[model samples]
Target: MNLEAIRAIYKFEMNRTFRTPLQSIIAPVISTSLYFVVFGAAIGSRITEIEGVSYGAFIVPGLIMMMILTQSVSNGSFGIYFPKFTGTIYELLSAPVSYFEVVLGYVGAAATKSMILGILVLLTAGFFVPLRIEHPVFMALFLVLTALTFSLVGFIIGILAKGMEQLQTVPLLVIMPLTFLGGTFYSINVLPEIWQTISLANPVLYLVSGFRWSFYGISDVDVSVSLVMIGIFLAACIGVVGWIFRTGYRLKS
Candidate 1:
């Protein structure tokens, strides 16, 4: 795409996010803070160390992962949904912008928002616990990759959704359950051997484990496996999203 087209799409997507400052910023930060308080402060004191890190510290990566995944998904879902709802997407669809350009613009902005929220939550957690990063580069990589993966998922859902209600349902019913079951609050090692094997099926577990590895220099699952899983998820989402947009799946109808 030309620079002009790229600029237009980027600005449009960014403006949509900034338009609702509270929903985009304060809401996720506050909700995550509450998790830090309830789980990190209240429960952490009673639980002691988890895998050599303080319970409070152990949950920090999980909390950040949670915020990134949710916000990225929400941002991406809404980015496309609002235009479709307001009858403005026809302008976008007919414009000079390619589907690839459109995807990059929306996904880029969503990733930015996710990273911002991730950093904000990490900072907030620092106030309550002594936060440390075992691998800064790996931590950053996990954050970006996970955000992109979820943003693509959100894009698919946004295109499929018929109304505002459907937008909320996907995250509430699907994403939330996966996150909670994904070793967000505790280590998978704490589970029964059978349960541990089953929790391995959760996609979120790989994300959380990769993020945790970045924090404590250790992981319940191999960092390589987590990275591979994330890579595969990203690749799958990209392929599916490209197919959806290429066919104009729900967007054109």
Candidate 2:
């Protein structure tokens, strides 16, 4: 394996983030803070508690999950897309690097950034409301898996995208909505019977549910189920990425 190649790519991506701390780090923290302000003030006043946790605290895991998911995708997609957009990807392809090495660099950096943001957001949330982690081990597992899985999804997106519009569209149009609808602001159990059934079909629900369960020991589904759902999705994303590299789907063109 080309450890140097992976290290080079990883350092480049991480350096980019450090160079633009305002956009990469501060912006996300601020955006998440706004969610707490708007949701905590507007909704928390009325709802009070959900499953014995204060509304403000209850939403912490969801908010962190949302941030992790969106940022992972955005970072991974842009890390690769910029290379393609600038026509530098061919240079990368010509380099002494394997496809898996290339992926490790971009996806690893993205996941690292997302985890930082997730932890920072969690800390910031602690300032607003009481917090606890009944299952710290599982919480860490969910965080790492969610970041890596979504980062892979973003890698695939970056390769497939033809332009900036397409690169930005999927996260805005698809991922954001799914996160919101996936037990973020409210639990799916509160929904009507049919809506609950429909909500179960959303993959993001499992991510949020499992993370929330780790925090408060409550979730819409079993923790094992959440683990299974995430594992399946992670495997599927890995398979898709492997296929993309094997065929050179959009990268070769």
Candidate 3:
């Protein structure tokens, strides 16, 4: 409802990205390129194809998902955390802005950044491997949903963090491990039956599977299930954020 307030916050957060183009934009792009070089060249040579798609092409969705998850969390967490760290959160709190507007500002900026990075990596991937997108609409849908979901996750982490070390804890320790194990570079079907079942427990699997399905029409999990899983996760994040705002958890402290 408070469009002007949301826009101001959104612009402020987005402006930070422009200010640190090297860190905000270039670094993630370069890092993803390295993954393509290493995995696509060294590992891809030995493993030829997975599910009839070239090894290099197979990992594109997973790699992009990995980057989007990490960046979404990193950007979202840092965006709000900096305001908390600098003691400016109180000023924002005092403003006439609604909680929804504040969230839209910070999470919107983070998702926008992650989406841009996702598109850039997708384009960059073209140079490494021949690519085909069977369902462009589905691919874009997955991309936007993944970015928004993780951005919200990052927003929660930002509000809950007590310090810089705590800020980096979940993404490094939890998210990264889940992503690597989430059928990123290889299909889970190749795993032992037991491990394949265990892989299902990891939420990132659904994300990668669904996104990869958008590309090749193949997946480790059903695309419908993946959509449901993402919806649940997104809802959970929104619930947590709502609770945080209502309770004034860390924000009021």
Candidate 4:
């Protein structure tokens, strides 16, 4: 079903990433390394352990999650937004490409790029602190699902955005704050009981919690709950995308 169209779109997007490795890849990797240096090395020196794992190691999953979520969404949003910004989208709309195939190409590329960054960050973590995966399979599962989910979220952002400034609004204003407060640097259990209850309301907590559980086998929320939350979010995003296509929301115009 228009497999070649999908490949062309996928290849073009991927090539764009390669062409701007500095902005697309190296910058995030370096920023994350600084996070390790400041948070993991500087702060971790004072706090030795959290839930039996070294503070440095404990933050690894959270950092990875942060990088992937931001990157996935950024890439997904930019991938689509650029086409719209440059008016290339009208060309694609007139092409014999189905909406599903277009989504697959863009979202798939975004997720793939996010995974690449995530894996690199994971490898980079090995040098700062000892790393272990209690459940490698689940770790991979969480990594893949999170990348795909957030990439789709970014895709939606791209579709909704009417200008360049609008593209950064959600990720910087909403997502970045959610991630920092979502147990990226500390476990929610250590917070006051009241705060812990409030933390449960933040969706990013489940993502960080379950991913951490895959690494250390301890979590603030039930692992199954995290999985279910991700599933729900992913399904919701897919539903929104389908509706967008059906109604030609922000696309036809």
Question: lDDT per prediction?
Answer: 0.88, 0.94, 0.94, 0.94
**TM-score of each prediction:** 0.97, 0.98, 0.98, 0.98
> Which regions of candidate 4 fall more than 4 Å away from where they truly are?
none
Worst 10 residues of 1 by lDDT: 1-10
Which of candidates 2 and 3 is the stronger one according to TM-score?
Answer: 3
TM-score of 2: 0.98
Q: Candidate order by TM-score, highest to lowest? A: 3, 4, 2, 1
CA RMSD (A), model 3? 0.8
Per-residue lDDT of 108-220 in model 4, one digit per residue for the tens? 99999999999999998999899999999999999999999999999999999999899999899988999999999999988999999999999999999999999999999
Question: Backbone clash tally for model 3?
Answer: 0
**Candidate 2 lDDT, tens digit per residue, 1-253?**
9999999999999999999999999999999988987788677978868979889888899999999999999999999999999988887999999899999999999999999999999998888888999999999999999999999999889988999999999999999999999999998988999999999999999999999999999999999999999999999999999999899888885
Task: Score residue 25 of candidate 1 by CA lDDT.
Answer: 88
Query: What shift in Å separates residue 101 of candidate 4 from its native position after superposition?
Result: 0.7
Report how far off residue 58 is in candidate 2 (Å).
0.6
For candidate 4, give the lDDT.
0.94
Where does candidate 3 stray beyond 4 Å? none
Cα RMSD of all models vs. native, in order, equals 1.1, 0.9, 0.8, 0.8
User: Worst ten-residue run, lDDT, model 3?
Assistant: 42-51
